[model samples]
Target: MERRFEPPVDGRGAQSVSVPTRFGLATREADGDWRDYMEMLEGPPVKLRTSVVEEHPKTILTFNTSPDIGFDRSINAYRGCEHGCIYCFARPSHAYHDLSPGLDFETRLFAKPNAAQLLRATLAKAKYTPRPIAMGTNTDPYQPIESRYRITRSVLEVCLEARHPVTITTKSDRVLADLDLLTELAEHSLVAVAVSVTTFDPKLSGKLEPRAAAPAKRLAALGKLVEAGVPAHCSVAPVIPAITDEFMEEIVERAAALGVGSCGWIPLRLPHEVAPLFREWLSVHFPERGDKVMSIVRSIRGGRDNDPDFFTRMKPSGVWADLFRARFRLACKRAGLEKPNFELDCSQFRRPNVGGQLRLL
Candidate 1:
């Protein structure tokens, strides 16, 4: 018989600590039965620890033909994000590996230590045609663990050597550490970077994106990118209804002030397991307005928790969506920000010379 599962409760200080049985077998709660009695006899709840496992995949490049996005190929140096944003759409992907889309998505991480080597081999293929490769599309390439692993940096080095065009999207200030490589890529018209900023409220940001860099730090990184002549853009993404929608104008305005060339927004999406996870998050952080917020969201999503259609998912409709769009457009106009037109030069791509020798054509 198919097992039924209920939405899991948020842990005292963590988001969705226990795995829900919705995907498969029904299991007892972490604190149920004997554990519940023991907890009553003891004091606080048990802490969930994070674990990292290294994976050496046969290949590292992921290619897609989706119409919703611009790039055809992308790379993700990590499988799970440590930033722990409650609204992450990629969380559901973890379920395919028999992992929880809740706390397990954040605590149990995977790294590709041989990513650079694999990417180098892939790009050096004799029939490989050049196109701008994208990074951080599925999971953050520069998550906290990146500092120790430096896998993303290694991939960049490979791109730099090959004169390959690349685009990056990230919410961490950690990208700033690679400013030197970014600057070089800019000179060759081979790079574009988008920094995502959801809101300026530190408290709300902390609650929503527990481990991401602060709003100010992200803005500063954008500024630094622009100052270094890198094509920097701002992403005011996943605009939550009745929660962070109000900050649409402010985020765009701040990003423009930082010299961002373009800005875009994505409405909140709760696909599959994300719907329940997000609902639980809402109840915990915005109990007073959780229902009202979901109501507005549903109204815009055709009276449903989410819209999975590609075109509709990118373009939300409704009174609230119209208002937010108007505000965003006006702010962009006032701040002199325009849609990004700069494209990375694909014709300049060259395979890196192996063994310190020149390729004889």
Candidate 2:
């Protein structure tokens, strides 16, 4: 049997604590010595810290024609997320940088400082057609580093200046920091925000998404967005069976109570390296139900670790699927949550005054 890597665990009665798991590292550091195994057993005395590298790309807007997803274009201010959600599907993209899809996906990050400028140039193109530009499509735009870099905020400023419609999907309450911009966009029907709430249990949330905002904070953020007249939607995303599924109803009820008119859930998706990393997470965090969790996951994922097919991937089948579907349907109905009709106003978009393209009606 291969030796398992153990992450640091904090003392329960400790005043302050930080636990970082090595479940999924985008790339492993090259071994300089055979004593690495000895070092592992002894454990490091210090906590792991995050490192960022700035990337300057010619283009900032990315486009895809995936039929299942709602948006066709998106902007990712950062290349890697620090949230450390073991189930994140975007982890595989790190391999392009000679990185693995595990812990490296969270700790070693890339930021595009020129994102706002590139976005402005892209929008100034005469041939550019306006559609809702989705933010937070790959990694959380409001991740911890956003406060320092403010790249996402810069991108939004460009959107506001261009009158370009934009949508945000985030797990951080930091979106509230741009309430002024968001409020103005909402007034013009140019923005909509969706906040993903995984589970209401803080302990489980810490174990699953160690760096994400607390569940309560996410709900409060959603409430604040709605109260500020921003079109907000709550998603009980990646509802892990026998794990996070238990909190679906409660999450929905809370969202509904917060004046959130729209909410839904997504089943767990274990694409690429995410599957192994999540399994490792389960073995370390919930060894008792690790097998059970995978069992239910496979059952709903067409009897495999994941269903990669387009339509079927998002829409699971069989009795277990039906049960989750029914439960979510009833929960939404009971909570008076209805599907939100958030059609961003693309007609209001105007080319930004850049690249020799002056603002023209």
Candidate 3:
């Protein structure tokens, strides 16, 4: 007769700190291993992290009713980001899926493999109005996996086919890979690209943005984009006080040197889940300066970790914000990096009708 074995259980079954347990029948001991008789006793349940399959959104265009942004609509090719910036403002988005906004946010990523097909279908709609569609708003379109998925490239192809205007914002030098397509779009007045440079210092960049392209590579990409005749601009985002804020002048100067036509800077914002994550990161990377860094951040955030109000979120209030503005203005003045002059023309918009005028023709 066969015997059944029960799994060893810890203290509490439901509320126990450890995982679930099961039991198995003990068998005859053979070799020196005494546990072999237990067959396959249930010890601890192996946590299987499941990746949910999300339907490919048929319509690629998304409306942004929020007044905080300059554009009304945008598109993201991927869901979770692999960049793994501890201070990333988009981290909280993972909570919607019951996933940890920490390591899981970086590791378990999702890409919209059908983004190009959706873009084409959306653009082909007769009622679809053409506006400069923004890319890389929530997560970077050129993030690491973009190389394999090539979703961004496909989206660009759709925009090019429709002669639709596009404005891209990214921190990856991988944007250079789309140079030929971008140059073609530029000739038709259909494209603009902004490369975000948080800090020119490599060490600071290493901690703030773990998997992002090197700062030097971003600068080099800026130069390359400009040389390719694509309207290129520099954005120094989330400028932290007493830290990267000090490099404002140098960043502007270097941008101008790279032939970047325009430059902009935004004060640091540690909103939602980002504040604590950033604190943890700072504690690990710059333990000595962690407290000081949070103190300065609080000073700008009105003694809080974050300010969610639209006006205050992008550019914080108080002395720190004022100082940042003054320094940025002075630096831009000195570097001759005037405000971005690239204004996408909406007047030329035309939805190529099915049997009417073929745009490319």
**Local accuracy by lDDT, each model:** 0.81, 0.81, 0.72
lDDT of 2 by residue, 1-361 (tens): 4644445232111111121224333324421111111233334323556689999999998999988988999999997787777788787787667675665677779999999889998998899999999999899999889999999998988898899999999989989999999999999999999999999877677667767887889999999999999999998998999999989899989999999879978899988767767776776768899999999999998899999998788998888989999999999999998987798899988888775444555
Q: How close to the true structure is residue 151 of candidate 3, measured as C-alpha lDDT? A: 89
Question: If ranked by lDDT, best first, what sequence of candidates would result?
Answer: 1, 2, 3
C-alpha-based local distance difference test score of model 2: 0.81
Model 1 stretches astray by more than 4 angstroms: 1-14, 18-22, 25-48, 354-361
Residue 190, candidate 3: alpha-carbon lDDT: 91
**Number of the candidate with higher lDDT, 1 or 3:** 1
Where does candidate 3 stray beyond 4 Å?
1-55, 352-360
Task: Score every model by TM-score.
Answer: 0.89, 0.88, 0.82
lDDT for position 192 in model 2: 96
Candidate 2's C-alpha runs over 4 A off are: 1-46, 355-361
lDDT of 1: 0.81
